[model samples]
Target: MPAGPLRGTIRVPGDKSISHRAVMLGALAIGETRVTGLLEGEDVMATAAAMRQMGAGAAKHADGWRIHGVGVGGLLQPAMALEMGNSGTSTRLLMGLLASHAITAAFTGDASLSRRPMGRVIEPLSRIGASFTPSPGGTLPLMMTGAPVPVPIEYRLPVASAQVKSAVLLAGLNTAGITTVIEPVATRDHSERMLRGFGAELEVEELDGERIIRVRGEADLTPQTIEVPGDPSSAAFFIVAATLIEGSDLTIENVGLNPTRAGLIDVLRQMGASIEELNAREVGGEPVADLRVRHAALSCIAVDPALAPSMIDEFPVLFVAAALAQGRTVTRGLDELRVKESDRLAVMAAALTAAGARVEETADGLIIDGTGGEPLRGTANARVKTHLDHRIAMSLAIAGLASQAGVEIDDTRPIDTSFPGFIPLIEGLRHSS
Candidate 1:
């Protein structure tokens, strides 16, 4: 099979992290929030329904989406269990939400999500008068009781997880006093920034190499319009495609360049990718920019562990870029990747080796030996197993566009979790090629 090239401009979906926060914050606010460019993926949609079940109103607008908040500390009891669908974000954040409210609710999800650890959020939220009924090793499908009158807490994170931090901060929104989180590792601050953007009094301090976060409780949020930028994670596939595929020049517009999530750009640059940032500016208290990428000779470097929290979602595609580079790419600080939608590090190693890249697995990461800028040639029918992981599916699909025999992923349905327009985007690039 002859390998094809990627071309054309494709606007990816809004950032999944941002989309989740918008719905949640809007649900807690006192008025309506108009959200433009909302990512309508399953995870986000589940959050929308969860908000409605909790007595918050989310409606469709002509140009964007809208949410009317139920007021701070104003959540009503949900009639049924709030099904989070395939979203780890929803389940985690809701843990914080339920921890502060005076209600009892059960959370559930699909098979893949059911197995993920909820202990991270459960442990911290439990510190502030919230209780749980029998979760097996902190897994999902557990009944959680909210403290109708929550006690504000000064919690500390064991790891740098934005979800964990955000969960605590949101729960604090309704407590009697300030809620705080101390972190040795700094994850994305979108929640902190957006909380301030919506008129919440939040503070951040650094001490002893730890970030101390505090949020004022029992607040009222002012409704504001939100324009979500295209997701940088979604753009990772195309960025890797442009780097590995020759004669490729592509520009992705209006991508969120939040410092916390721009590690892939830095890693690609370190690997000698011909990437440029244009139209850098601030929108809605967060940065926005356009990314221009073209083919470049890449040499692998050791990816440091400290950078894992920032680009955690992009590692699968980054592995694809490593497979196309000339040298070995060794990554550290990615034990978290093992417990994502799939064991992504192992999944990438096995899938890339099957496509003719030399890859080795370690305790935390992978080492890939590239073909000296040579394209991979494999059997015509080698199928990359996605393990029902969306990122893995999208990464393998992008690899198929650059491989020698042209790859086919075992499942493409999972791509809708973040990039619902993936097939059409790929098809568009194929047409231009």
Candidate 2:
């Protein structure tokens, strides 16, 4: 089973971040908003279901989908707990949505999501008249009481989390006055963009070095038809796989090149991976274009700490690529990885080392001494542990394509979250062999 060139025009799934926000803001807006090309992954789908639990009626239409909004400040109390399956995005953002309303809601998720700490969000949102009865350690299975005319406060994020920022902002929508949140490190701005798109009075200001986002209460939203661009994150695995596979040439179409999320592309190019941008254009305020990635001799480069937020979800795959490159790649400011779907940084370091890649793990990030563009000589039989993470599983599978010994992922089920067509898409690329 040799790695093959992936040559085709692949339309990746809808942007996960944008898709999550679209469904959520649509549910909060009044009238009908038709959303085409929504990410139907488990995470985004969980958001759709969460919206319905909160008095939002969203139904599928002929060509697009329609959501009858509950209007800002008009959400009814849900009768039962909101069950978010395997989606941290759905759970965290919904907590914020649940916070500002005068409703009591409980939220729960799968075991993987339950372990993630909710205290970061709970601490800030609780100030705005909301109260929570979270499991010990502020983990999930959270019972929330949304504040009526919630108090708007200035919150400083302990860490750089787009989810926490969006949560506070969403809760701010129901607050009586402006709610301000400051982040020293900027995360993805999808929620902020989509909020304004829905006609909310949101103001973003930079002070000192942080992004201070203030939103005026009680939004009057206009219906919108969002054309979601292809997901760049989902495209990352294929790009790395194709580039690592000798004689490979692949073109990924219509990928969202949001400045906040294109770090993976930049890093790949810096590592001497041949990636080109084509048909550059803007869609719904985000720059999008086709990506052409080709096989090339590779060398690793030390990553800038600033790029972490943009490519946070891509570190695992990037690690795989770095292991196959010519020089050492050092990464820093990645403390955020400790609490993701799995302990990504540590877990990936262990897995890469297990498969004959030299990796040094740190509290915040990793330093990988590469194999100098050599295919990893994996152990006699190594089953890469995915730890129930989609990205990790996909990355290991891609490694199999290029490693001396093909890789096996523990479970590939989670790949459906973003890239439902992953295996088949890669298999189809066999023609390029």
Candidate 3:
């Protein structure tokens, strides 16, 4: 993984979360919705395909992806099961889309995704009058029948899950009344923000330390032209890589800096990473910025548990950053990581350990002893297992670049689930250097 300092300006793919919601919402709108800068990742593509299968017109043009939606409550029952490759986000959010429509659909996915718990979405969606027949473990390969006469109810999230919250709110869109989601802990607000952008009557208010998000039912969604900002989660890999490798000064352009999704930047800055926001501005109703990250001496700090939701997807890479910091890094309140495409906490712990990082796996989080800014010894002759997780693959790839011996990953194909051109992007930086 030895290399000279990384130097370049790059724009990662569009935000996956926002892209997924855009496709879903566009498919449910009344007219043609155009989306530029849409993420073409496998996960987001799955949502598009599912929407197409349910009588929506989804096509990619030279400019961007375009969607001709079936109006609200106009979804057709799919003739075949919806195949969600490795995207839990797609599966969960699409489940919500199906909940209030008068459509019956079956959801299937890859082995990693099939193992993930869908019960979180299932319980609340069922309360909104959707009928679900989940597998034995409450995982995928599930069958769902959307409510013929949906009911609107207020649901309080038992855990901090944006997916679950999104599912309930989406179901409310086709029901007769308001669907309320009470979040004791906030997750990403992309769903709420995009819902409002599409003309859904949604409002958010905070009361007594909890967030109350309500969406009016039977929404008349208007078509929109959306420009998805660059994915901060995707850009996180380069940010960490640049910070860990000496002499690196890299700038990532048009990155989404949504407060709920920008916690990684805050934590990294607190750990003494030199990340500067240049040309901070707004794009598509979300905060956007170009980030200039330079190599810096890093000191590990205890990660606050409360910040997990905002940067949940970036923790694998953050673990890699922590593994190379000056001291031990402790993280907790990440049990949610256990239910992602893979067991991220365990997989990252084992992968880094194989590459010579001192790591202790905990029930909820990990304890990583950094190399004190030195290159990892790498796996020597062994390969790190990705477990079909995109973040695990990319995070270890970054680790490899800072390793004495290049890290070998068992599979990097999973990267296409989110960051499609990751290898090419890294190679471009290497060649440019």
Candidate 4:
């Protein structure tokens, strides 16, 4: 932990979720799409590379990224396998983008992504006439054959997953009729928002508390200028860092405050954190704000199940916060954490326990008994296994800030997939103080 309070106004990289969509949708549109504040991380860069391989002119410019697209249904067969490079978002969503294009494409990823299940996206896409030959256990390194004249169908999401939902919706873009997805639980709406922004005819209806999203097929998308907001997920580590470190005061600027993705803020506030949303505004169809977070004494609270979809990616760091707060923090309805880049639920529990915090791992979530604001007894010799998950690597690094002996991480390479500048940013903040 630093000897003094951290004080600074910093902006993280652009929103990863939105940046992925921007690149994918930009590649599918009929004309040029200009994206400002695009995240140049490895994951998003993978999407750009795939787009270029399939006939899109995705190139960098002085301002941002400029993408000249191959219209819907116009994708060319790639010469080699599309290397996804640890991005599950890129793999799943790209599978959907190619699902109706009458092309044969093979997708592959690094070890972490190769271990994740692709069946969620594969099953729904197959229902819409796409054929796939995935690895055993339905993992990646899969070959896909798209249906030239595809038929659209209504899909009801069994789980709340934005990537799965986006895959189905993107597959429907070039089909023959209207394709509808009924989400039993809401996930991030970045795909839907970006789809509509690109001139695709899409409709959203909420009935009986379920969202029914419909998109017309054979639709042509018009390109536009987009400015992506800062990622809330990347900001989570800083928010927890400032909250736990005594006397710290920091401001995170231009963070995407999309209600669907801002659940971490709500949960932290519920735990007695001092977070103020300043300069509330909208950018590129999403809510944006500057968050002023100050160190405060926090108490534990039961996190609601419904909040899972919104804060799913933030849970790892939230677990760290729980380990430092007073009393116990209980979380449930997070089985989805088990399927991320690593088994986040189990890995987080194990890592926190090694740091001298009491954590009980459940089937769905974790039960953490906090140390009541005391410094964690982690040692420099105690290394946390990140399993190549970006969130896990970054979350544990933030934990090291307040640990007694400073935590050691097994690998930080995974951080390049999302927040490439995370370590530098943290070092700058500490050095400034």
Candidate 5:
């Protein structure tokens, strides 16, 4: 059965990265901070809850959300463990924030998050005097005691990870000196951008293709109003959906076009996607734009490894797009995908294969043989295993739109973590079509 093309303009939820930072930074500012267009997803809510647990007054308002800060070095020890839910951003960044505050904090998460490693942050933060007693393999369900007298250090990221970088920076907030992070490959700079917006003395320099970010310690952050732009990662599903379904024409509004997070658009265009940027503007220190996308004949191309950091979160859906394109698509330098909410590379390979696509899982990436614009022969009983990963659940849902039998997902609950209204949004677009 063929599905109709998608139409209508849709605004995705606020950028998850920005939303998480807003809550975290707002709680650290000296006064009240008001935020509009904050994502009310579960992950962000978990951050809000954790802030409240640490003595910040975070509450929902009629227009948006509000946070009363605890100021620098003023966080209270939580009465119990911080329940981080499924947000790795919340857990890792909070670990950094707590690392130098002289507070003992215990952090725990759901089963999926507990399985993911926290060693990357634990190791770097421990060097700054933070001590952790983590579950084996440096996984979650751990306790961290902040350094009474924190010492700053210049650290180079072994892996390109925004969470790791942000963790180190956040930990440096109350340390005695400047903390610097040198990235071999630039990751998302939401923490840096938002930190500066909150009045932290931070500097960024590019030397020999590496980004050096430094933040001064014991800086006071001033509260300000923030209006988070729409999340481009969430918009990606519809972008690929419209590009794959013939006769489709759609527009996504208020999407953050931050250079660090817009690699998907570039990569999709490289694969022959028809996407236009309209009414470009700036929002909350990030670029914002409306995107007009249409159906196009796609050709698979070998993706550059350097593009991984910018589009890391969008790979699952990108893989879905590749499965319907012409020729073969090869992706490399994506070992990071294996440690996400799920083993995205292996899960996507299994899911797409179950849906009748030829996908070969690689050690670090995937090789996909495209169907040359043909619909997948999805069986009614072919349930895609979501493994509690929101991206995987949503990506497979989009694949269902172009499947003859309409794909079924093992779980849609995880979608609430990022895009709570995803199914309703898809249904509305389908009805409009």
Candidate 6:
């Protein structure tokens, strides 16, 4: 499908995770928080719109995005339902932020997001004194009434989820005392670090092989200028494309390399891919570097389950790399994938199989047999069902690039949710290279 090698220097969108947190935290600060390099994706725009609806001042300027805050516990009741579009992060985090305030709001999303569970956040927020009336099966299209006098308590995560951890921490922000979260497995620490940056009293300690995070509630926040970095998650498609396509030598610039989120790079390196880190630096409290990737012969290996937290969102694309590798790639301990935007495990397995690769779906993970680096002759007239999941659409597009015939997706509209202009970027690289 690809005309030739994809060789170029490019930068993906700003970190989606960081961009979401910045707007939320900035809206709770005392003054204007200016953010440069904010992602202008539909998902993030939904968060910003929700913030604006709740009395935060959000507007785009010639320089960047400027958000005027109303301080902690200052959110106003929205006049309409908060449309979340497709962002689980925005919904869960906002539920926590609203849990300790005295306002009531309704949360709704598109069909894909409506199927994902919100009970993970609801259980903790309910304990913090908020009340929720979720749809059948604890999904969205729900009403949440904030606790006028919220209670602070210690919560232990029943599962490994950064969203769950962040929800509890955010609810603790407007509470009256110290609230704590005990994480059996560490997820991303963006919330913890960003909380401290915005002047919340927070502490982290490791005891008995678990992480304990505590935050003082009802704290005042200070606004600051934030320089967001390129997203590594958005960078994955091109990274894998460059690695799988012959003669590809691509340099992706300013990708966030947070240690907690770099497991994909590690796994690819273990599978014998050529990725070199250049210009290592730190921006906005996160490590970042340029990645120079070249096409190389890949081999299969069993992925470490513990690394799942770091690379959870990446497994879909990783499945593509594995399908064309030299042996069977065994991935396990991915039970969490079942609860994402779609059942990523099942969707990716089916998509790869339809594209002429050998992929077996397992209960918790996927078992994929590689083509030993041979380009797949894609199945004729069989299109990939993306299920409105953006990663699936993009990952399969990359598969088409490395195949004799192009992969066809049911829809590419979902690609704009996170990585807008994705097709243009790929086309630019294809023609210029």
Best by lDDT: 5
Q: Which stretches of candidate 3 lie over 4 Å from their true place?
A: none
Candidate 1 lDDT by residue in tens digits, 266-364 = 999999998898889988988998888888999989998899999999999998888888888899878899889888988888888888888899998
Per-residue accuracy of model 3 over 52-118 as CA lDDT, tens digit each: 9999999999988899999888888899999999999999988898888878899999999989999
The candidate, 1 or 2, that scores higher on lDDT is 1
Worst 10 residues of 3 by lDDT: 1-10
Runs of candidate 2 exceeding 4 Å displacement: none
lDDT, candidate 1, equals 0.87
Model 6 over residues 132-177: C-alpha lDDT tens digits? 9999999999999999899998999999999999999999999999
> Clashing residue pairs, candidate 1?
102-148
What candidate 5 gets wrong by more than 4 Å, as runs, is: none
Candidate 1 has what TM-score?
0.98
Candidate 6 residue spans exceeding 4 A from truth: 1-3
Residue-wise C-alpha lDDT for candidate 5, range 1-433, written one tens digit per residue = 7579998888999999999999999999999999999999999999999999999988998988999998989899899999999999999999999999999989999999999999999999999999999999998899999999999999999999999999999999999889999999999999999999999999999999999999999989999899999999999999999999989999999999999999999999999999999999987789999999999988999999999999999999999999999999999999999999999999999999998898999999999999999998875865778899999989998888988998899889999999989999999999888
The C-alpha TM-scores of every prediction are: 0.98, 0.97, 0.99, 0.99, 0.99, 0.99
Q: Report every candidate's CA lDDT.
A: 0.87, 0.86, 0.93, 0.92, 0.94, 0.93
How many residue pairs of model 5 clash at the backbone? 0
Tens digits of per-residue lDDT, candidate 2, 93-124, equal 88898888989999998898899999988998
Pairs in clash, predicted candidate 6 = none
* lDDT score of residue 419 within candidate 5: 93
The residue pairs that clash in candidate 5, if any, are none
